[model samples]
Target: MLPLGGSHAVAEGQAVLLVAHADVTTQRLTRDTTRAIFAMRQRTWPDGQAARVFVLPNDNPVHERFVKERLAVYPHQLQLAWDRMVFSGTGQAPDRVRHQAEMLERIATTPGAMGYLEREYLDDRIQVISMD
Candidate 1:
């Protein structure tokens, strides 16, 4: 079993939850690919699907730490990358959700929505993607 309240516990296929205002295209991403996509590196899938990322609020410690340690990128770097994309009119950053529950709800309803969540919280409506 994975430990609680630490970065190690969140691994591949563990269902990372994301939230938005009820519209976005993203769901069930590989852990490494998700990390890359979130960092704004991998823009499209091998199948030619556009990668859409949804992120939690910056203030959330879990979100911050995950990006820092797992992605090996700072939040400011993510912002800068996103800003650059926006300025260039390439693609904007993923939408944001207000809270975990909201993220779950929005991701559940939205097609192609991808997000992370604790494995314990997963349900039938949400499909967990393996980070392994």
Candidate 2:
């Protein structure tokens, strides 16, 4: 088992969650911007390119970790925000994938796509976005 607070622990990685996309840009996103993107509040990156956000189900552990640790928000809060956005016609929810492989596939193929992943599941197809 992974050691408590180990270098590989999910919690530890969650704090510095790797946000990757298919684009070649070396843009490092600010924390607020990252939060805005995931919260569906921001539609474009700093470069003005449309940002396509992907995510796993709300109940998934990695999803929970990402929301809580990376975004500094709770899953339920994010869900409520998403609901408000969709119902208000101001924004739409992110594309959802069932697992890491699917998330990887979507982000790697889709343009301006962004999503968080554990380091081990990461590969070359996706470009990492650093959080400011």
Which run of 10 residues does model 2 get worst, by summed lDDT? 3-12
RMSD to native for every prediction? 5.5, 3.4
Candidate models: Cα lDDT each:
0.61, 0.80
Model 1 Cα lDDT, one tens digit per residue, 97-126: 776666677667765566555556566776
> Which candidate leads the pack in lDDT?
2
Question: What digit string (tens of lDDT, one per residue) describes model 2 on residues 61-90?
Answer: 889988877788999999999999999999
| Consecutive 10-residue window with the lowest summed lDDT within model 1 | 15-24
Model 2 regions more than 4 Å off: 1-16, 24-26
TM-score of each: 0.67, 0.86
